[model samples]
Target chain A: MIDKRVGDPAQAVADVKDGDTVLIGGFGEAGSPIELIHALIDQGARDLVVASNNTGNGQVGLAALIAAGRVRKMICSYPRSSNSRVFPELYRKGQIELELVPQGTLAERIRAGGAGVPAFFTPSSVGTVLAEGKEVREFEGRPYVMERWLRADFALVKAELGDRLGNLTYNKTARNFGPIMCMAARTAIVQVSRIVEPGGIDPEVVVTPGVFVKRIVEVANAAHESVLVAQGVTYP
Target chain B: MTAELIHAGLTRDEMARRAARDIPDGAYVNLGIGIPELVAAHIPPGREVIYHTENGVMGFGPPPPEGEEDPELINAGKKPITLLPGASFFHHADSFAMIRGGHIDFCILGAMQVARNGDLANWSTGAPGAIPAVGGAMDLVAGAGRIVVITEHCAKDGSPKLVDACTYPLTGRGVVARVFTDLAVVDVTSEGFVLREIAPGVDLDTVRRLTGAPLLAAAGIKTIEP
Candidate 1:
């Protein structure tokens, strides 16, 4: 039996070293690994290139991580959220760099990376500024811009349930980038609400199989930035 | 002081309703933010249209009941939403795959400007202070089978939004099929912008005068359904 369970959040993310590209999965605040993100912050990895759908909202999770001066750059679609302030301030002051990909392109790049595709042409941002200096080709008489694959050193994802072997299930929209992130990274560390045995989950419902997952961290109460904002939670 | 008259067009909800009429039954539609989002409320009962939100959800139903809003469950614009019975959610990559893969039948998006050649520019004005937020408009416009642009007829400063060329950043070129302005419904054909309908109480002369391009009246003028 290949058990991928880790003792705690610290151990789960202990392998993520400085200067590694980390793919943190989430859309807005849904499906974000807040506890593991906090643990990563405590781990104090520096000069990391963080790729995500959004930066951080409120002052928790990714935003807090950025505030702590951990991330050196971010590759994302939408970096701003309702309560997000840290990224903007750092972005303007030239402390961090940004590679803004269209939301669909970002997701597709990750998906392509996981499927072992090195590059693919897409029509998403053909004529926009995002397509500048990229290879453009005519496929079936329609123009498509070539997008390279995006892989991460490690991916921190949030799942609703996980078996010891790392078969993961997810919550609603919270599953936003979890499944794809697991496949696009070398080491996938999932934060689950509950941990069960290998045979605990029905084979049919396993959204992300254990083969892609490297570690599973059980965090019963996964804090979300959206929930915190709803509850009027903030930080100075 | 002499009294002056002002011209106004359909309300936001009315524009949404007009756009909804074009959607066929069982169409997998993606509604962009702003006026397009209102189409969900006006989706005429009995139409089995499945709504897709890019934040990773399909089969949007209604606004969730008060106090039942789930923070984790939200639309692309980050607003809480309700899910229909058969609604499914997935990761970001899958959501975009559904979009770029051409699974969506139609897309109704809000725009800042649309060109006579069907070019769309809604994401940014490229102004110094304007936030450059292009979520999924480019992907939907480029991949959806057809694109319907719903927007106010003109900017608040009295500049027309439907122009010969877009002055803002282009989201996609030659992607828009139809444009539903507050005052008129126009189709973007190879010929040019053809006026299809005029808002109630509005005249063809008034619409022609306000349009920035050479507008041709359609053979049949349809009513702007509220």
Candidate 2:
């Protein structure tokens, strides 16, 4: 059993070391573990290999890590304009390594890791560049490409609410990358705005149960910067 | 009543060429994944349509040749894609911004079903044991200037896919503008559904008979010119 309560974001993220592989859960700022990410950035961690569905918004999400020059490598489905400047420049200068995976395959790889399935096969990448250097197998007379599972040393996730036992719930798009990432990493750290007692959450509503989560921190305001940037505009 | 026969059973590539011809120069377009992706390959030379992808790529191009595939470049589906000049990648936020902000002028999406009222339900079929994924179809329908659907005319069961109403989960309500199927080009207008042109070798009545919904004929409907 893992402790659901932690001292602070810094302490939870302190377990991360240089050159460590980490998965930060988010799909464009929806469910990003902003507190832990801020801690990692503030700590000035370097040479990190970060894996996620997409980079954070510029100056706000995981892009901050790239902007801080902390990420030495990136494994993702796509690199967008928010972090686009960093990738090509670093690749040209031979400073960073970038590995792109098919989005569905990437999602499956992480899901497989969480499920303890070492590998699986799909036909999506066959005959494409994605099939290069990968083992190919035939099932039912059709070619299927095999992809390995993705595991990270640490997984940082954000949730809308959690129980003292670490069970979590997410809202809308924020749920995109959080639940699967929680199981694919060796240590799962979560940040939530509200924490309730164990058994307080309904089992049906729990997106990620307590067993997979190792630590949890409470953040007063996850979108403070974005709100400040928006100033007087009301957010829904 | 015309004697000119438009070719039926055209290849997917040919359908792509037909679709690309309708996209005017200087339009910002979004190509849905799968067969719709081929549209980028057939873009007419000298046309300046900027491609916006949900994965945060704009000014997109075709896939790179084998051995030259850059792992860093990919499309909305996460497949490796190439970037044209003046292309840029941004965080997913900005990518959705381009979509939801109405910066896109055209969206050419593949469809499972299109209704007489122009309702589109392409994201998930809701079929048991089928893959369930909705992606960014909702944003494309609501944000793009025009929503064009590209798909085949019928299912394997020989049932017409163009229906009175979509049976599958709808990505948007009454959002489609025009549709290009294997057999015909139809427009969803305020008056009703109208057949603009039929594919070569297919008659307008045959096309109408195969469709499940009521379809009206354009005043000067004819076989589509290649």
Candidate 3:
């Protein structure tokens, strides 16, 4: 019985400590683990370094966490969102730090972190301002900038389905960073829409294997950030 | 000014249609957010193009009908999309691997500035206090096999977009293969901005005047039919 199910979002995120590098999975509101993020907010961990695609939209999820001053830094490709003002304001006043990597490079760095690679060379930011202060080397007559791997102390992810064994699947584009972040973290806590039996999911379609996942909390009906933002909902 | 005079040369959609014609059948294409996204609707009939969105979908279909939008099913621009028959989802690493690995055929982008040397500066203006958001622009420019930019001939303030050198931050150095502007179809060659086609009713002199860099007419320059 390799059951990794947790009772609630609070319990799932209870162990996150201050100064941990957390990978919050989502490309905007799509795959955001809202309940878990809100729970982490209530749990009151401070000075977190979060890595995600965007800062967040409106005043919920990642934005709320940032508003709560729980995040000290953001490592992302794009920090601005259509409805996000939290990151920009904080960034302007120098309250938060930012490390902007190109989207593909960010993905590859996380993949490299999970795959046990220390660093890799890429042409994504070569000769651009983003490539400044980095090591540049040419291979086969083409220049490439070296980017280091990105690992997190914990990864909070949202998934479509999960079994007691922790194997998971995701919904559409929401699957963007979930699978990779799971592998790149010391502990991957997932909030799934449904929890099933061990044999419920097809083995071939499991996006995040049970090995990378530590805890699974069923969020049955997850709230979307767009609807929340539209309703002017602000998290605690 | 009459409407005819105010709306001169190819329209934005027409520019996209013209750019769409260059995409070969069965090619894997990535469309940047704005004007370049229009290229898909105008892709020639009978061509089976596989669309790739960097957010982790391949063979993406048209936008879902109104009211059926799924927030999770989206394109690289974060707009809702449908899954085409051959659609498959993968993680971010594999998605970018298809790109940086040189597996994608074409990537069409919108540009803020394009230098004669093919340098692009679409990501930022380098303005102080402006929060820069690069997204996948740099990756697409660096990895896509053929980088074609579709943009207006001039900026809103009437400054030339096709300039001698990009004044803003660079997305890539000498990466643009071709450019489709409202006024003309241009190619970025070692020689300079070579005009391949001229929009009907627009003269070469107007293009040369608007272009910040010198423009060269290619041999047998044709009138844009779209």
Q: Tell me the DockQ of each model, to 2 decimals.
A: 0.72, 0.04, 0.87
TM-score of 2: 0.55
Candidate 2 ranges with C-alpha deviation above 4 Å: A82-84, A224-236, B1-226
Tens-digit lDDT string for candidate 1 (A1-236): 68899999999988789999999998888888888998999898999999998888867888988988999989988887678888988887889888988999988889888999999999998888889999999999999999999999999999999988889999888888899899999999999999998788899989999999999989998776777766866443
Off by over 4 Å in 3: B1-7
Report the error of model 2 at residue A123, Å. 1.5
Mark the 10 consecutive residues where model 3 chain A has the least summed lDDT: A73-82
Candidate lDDT values, in order: 0.87, 0.74, 0.93
Candidate 2 lDDT by residue in tens digits, B1-226: 2211323555677778888988999998999876688887788999988888765568877877897754335566655667788986543434555665678888899988888888888766656543234456665675678899888787666777889988887766678899888788899988658999888878877888778898999888877655
Instruction: Give every prediction's interface RMSD.
Output: 1.4, 13.6, 0.7
- Model 1 chain B poorest 10 in a row by lDDT: B1-10
- lDDT per residue, candidate 3, B1-226, as tens digits? 3223443689889999999999999999999989988998998999999999998999998899999999999888889999888799988899999999999999999999999999999999989998988888889988999999999998887888999999999999999989999989999999989999999988899889888999999999999997
Task: Kindly report which residue pairs in candidate 1 clash with one another.
Answer: A176-B91, A176-B92
Q: Residues A1-236, candidate 3, lDDT per residue (tens digit)?
A: 68899999999999999999999999988899999999999999999999999999989999999999999999998898789999999999999999988999999999999889999999998989999999999999999999999999999999999998899999988999999999999999999999999979999888888999999999988999999999999998
Highest lDDT: give the candidate number.
3
DockQ leaderboard ranking: 3, 1, 2
